[model samples]
Target chain A: MRWDFASVFDNTDALLVGAAGTLRIFAICLVLGLSLGLLVGLGRYSRNRWLHIPATIFVEFFRNTPVLVQILWFYFALPILLPFQISPLAAASLGISLNSAAFSAEIYRGGIQSIETGQWDGARALGMRWGQAMRRIILPQALKRMLPALTNRAIEIFKMSTLASAVAYVELLQQGKLIASLNYNPIEAYTAVAVIFFVFLWPLVQFSYFLERRLRRDE
Target chain B: MAYQWDFSPVLANAPLLVEGLVNTLRITGTALVFGVALGLGLALLRLSPRRYLSWPAGFVIEVFRTTPPLVQLFWFFFAMPILVGIEMTPFMAGAVTFSIQSASFFAEVFRAGIQSIERGQWDGARALGMRHDQAMRRIILPQAVKRMIPAFMERAIELMKTTTLIATISYADLLFAANEVSQKTFRPLETYTVVALIYFVVIFLASQVARLVELRLARSGESTVH
Candidate 1:
């Protein structure tokens, strides 16, 4: 029933490093997942069968399975499929990016689809090439619309990054487990971890809300 | 060089995987029922006019939703015994934690459903001289529940997938069974692939059902509106 803050305070540096590691995992996943997802997303909307089919399979396959299973698969099995071994961080990031890419692709597709048909027509009416229109006309507006969803996915990625610990990645949750088991103070250790998550995530949630409000106002 | 993909290890351990799948479903089903019940209660509390009732409820809901479920799971399984002076089995701890955390998310969905009912619905209820509780139960809820069906189904799908977290606590759930089979057979690749496929099939089917329900809800909502 009693919580000892002293044990938690004593391991502050370790927890902070764990948190930084977590942030790094999240950052890499967000950047790579979205970049790859952008391509896959455009492929999702593509008319060609070759591009569209693979993209659909990729999205559905990743979306349907648990990210945890994927992480385990990457950690335990992926190296067997490849020539070389990967570090835990590398394996974890690979698995998470694949999962994130699926959801991110959907978010991108949603953003692109939301733009009015007339916007495309308007671009053509101005005699702009398709590439010119996509880059300068459609993309700018689509990026604005996608920000809130991307913000949401960022939060999702943050939460999912906690799974890295299960794969021996030495992330925040794993570190908390170590410190707690060592200190025999689960309450204090877990409370610190929970507080850290809340502090980091609350702002992203607020930002998503604010963006939603602003976007709704724009309409 | 060619790599061999063996299915014999997974096939040999089929019974355990099947048992694990069933356990996973059982856990998810229990959590869904408890989560919805708790969520509805919390939603009503947050919607209450009394500051004393609503304020604390909102705070609890906010904190639950903001934190990762894994942390909560660990806290409940590991810390609960020390704090509460009663030991719980892994299943019991998981059920309680997932229910509460799922309730937090479901509470928000319920709030949105209730709020989305047009203000005119309330006015109409009042014009008919219905009391607040009566109006909510008899009129507002029936429609709101219909609108909420799609969201609830989607969350159900998500919750089902989250059942895998129980494996972390050494629960002999599907993923844990997969791990054991892999270690036993020394075919980690084959075993995890099978587990992933099982998840893919189950979730894919659930999502399709959700889509169908969504379409039906959309049609009914349109008619109900007019």
Candidate 2:
């Protein structure tokens, strides 16, 4: 058997489209997941039972289950309860974003909790409200510590974006599947896909390591 | 129109779901045992004084860690057979992929755990006429393994969740069984929901156990490694 990449190179257009789809979903999930996570994390940190109970439940349920299951649930089961059919992208996005939210919520909570009480007290002494204190003082400091974890989460989200293909969303893996089936070159096609992912993720993984090392040194 | 919720179809397919769950555990168990053992070996090789052994181990860990598992799965399941001239079953492919995948992660944990031990301990061992391997086997590993329990449990749980990906390759894991039952019953909602809940229960219990172990470790005043 001989190794050939000519077929994969000829299908660069398909891979490019898949790359765009993967990036699109990654951006969507990053924004949705992190922002939603902040709210849920605040809920988890809240003093009220009303906020805390539901947030805890949400985190536990999503975190405990496999992400693919969540994606499948949104894709296949969710539409039955709604008036309209769900798009593959929508289903995939919802599942990935929500699942990411659950994981990142813990990061947010841990970051916030790690803040020294002295800082919170200082904010209160300055006559700042809870929201003001959190936004102006707590989050800024917490964010530095959270940066490594959040970067890790972003990488994870990028990787998880491949699951969108399970719902027939036009991601890199889905495109690879298309290319392989069409050209009958599963070896080159899948190898290309794996290399593409490694190339895309290597820098991010390095950045995360840099952040972690820097954080460890600084702290 | 109110679409009435029905679980009767899912309930009737209990046997299938049970079998799926068993397969899931089987895969998880196989992967966990091999992953930990292989992980330790990789970690030790990575920690080697020789460049050749360390470099290859580092490469394997980094490559596996860097790429997505599904891509690896596809490469192993679809791409591997042609290249190696051997037929590959889904279970075989899934097991191999996950064992190496989880092993890469476990390698890091083991490396950290081993490194976390103070240099004085090694010095003490060497001063006691213990050879490197002798010190590592008896003195270093026992303590490292204790600190590593929480991280190991967490990884094992993650591995279980990851086993769901095998379903994509047509492995009759729980998630695959869900798809089969859902199509058969024409009750996607009930079937998927049931499977999700089943996953939730099993994983939740496992997580609770992990948490309990971590808590016990903490209470016992053991410093755990991530």
Candidate 3:
């Protein structure tokens, strides 16, 4: 019943590397997912069915399925389908971003919808092109409303980066699992990782709350 | 560039996949019932006036909610027996962790739903000389329950997807069975594609149902809810 963190401390370098791997994937997915999501979000708002239907399907397929399953599918199926090999790290990143892109698209769509139709029409009335209107008027307003939700989603994908461990990407949880099994002390290892994650993520969670309150006050 | 795209290997192993799917539902359903009840209790504790009662519950709920459920799954599956001196089967560990994780989320949903009720309703109940418990039970909950339905179902869909994490610990879940079959048959593409399709269909249907419920509630003028 005695807890020993000595074994965990001994492996701090490995865990740090693992945490670095997680952050790397998190950073990659955050950029790719949100960018792709923005495109898809625009597609969702487009008048053309060509854009709308496909965007909706993409969002629905990724959002409905579990990210773990999606990761496995990417790790296994994509290489075969492409007739080329994908490194596991790339596969995991692709999977996570695609999954996150689905949610991001919806979040973006919601933000856009939250804007009044009158503001949209007013932009047109002001002799602005669609792109100019969006960039100048609609976006400035929607981004403020959407910042908190988007940050929350970003934090979510950051936590989800741990699932890369399932694909053998050697992220934080995998590092901890290996160490725990090696040292015959699963409790200590998991406890260490839990504390690490809490310390790392608690700030983001706090910031998300602050954003939520600030947004509420603005309303 | 010619891939055969054979699916016979996966089709031959349909029974195992079905069993795994059923197991997935079982885990999610069991977790949902207990999680929601425990969540309601946690919400009550959090709403209690006494800090001694609410603070600990609030802290636990926040920690669980913020942390990844996958890590929690690992801790419960690997660390719990060592810490508590109680041996838990893989399924039991999965169920317990998911229950706790889902409870944390549901607590927030319930709290939000309760808080979304207008203050005038509380004032009206007070003016009528109704006790707090009576007002909550008789006046507030009926309305809140209706609002909670769409959100609860959405969480249920999310919870169903999350149950797949149990496969990592070698539980015989749909994804696990698919993995086993693919490994044996050397048809990873076929087996995994089918598994993905199954998940897509199930969750897609659930989301559609949730959307219909939300639309109906909105049509009926119950849209001013959390």
Question: Each prediction's Cα lDDT score?
Answer: 0.89, 0.96, 0.89
Q: Mark the 10 consecutive residues where model 3 chain B has the least summed lDDT.
A: B217-226
What TM-score number comes out for model 1?
Answer: 0.97
Ordered from best to worst lDDT, the candidate numbers read: 2, 3, 1
Task: Return the top candidate by lDDT.
Answer: 2
The DockQ figures for the candidates are 0.82, 0.92, 0.83
Which sections of candidate 2 miss by over 4 Å?
A: none
Better of 2 and 3 by lDDT: 2
Which residue pairs show collisions in model 3? none
Give the winner by TM-score: 2
Q: Write the per-residue lDDT of candidate 3 for residues B1-226, one digit (tens) a residue.
A: 5788999999999999999999999999999998999998898789888999899989989888778888999999899988999988879988999999999888888888888888999899999999888998888877777878887888889899999999999989899998999998899999999999999999899999999999998899885344
Instruction: Show model 1 residue runs off by greater than 4 Å.
Output: B221-226
- Which candidate tops DockQ? 2
RMSD of candidate 3 to true structure, Å:
1.4
| Candidate 2 chain B weakest lDDT stretch, 10 residues | B65-74
Off by over 4 Å in 3: B127-129, B224-226
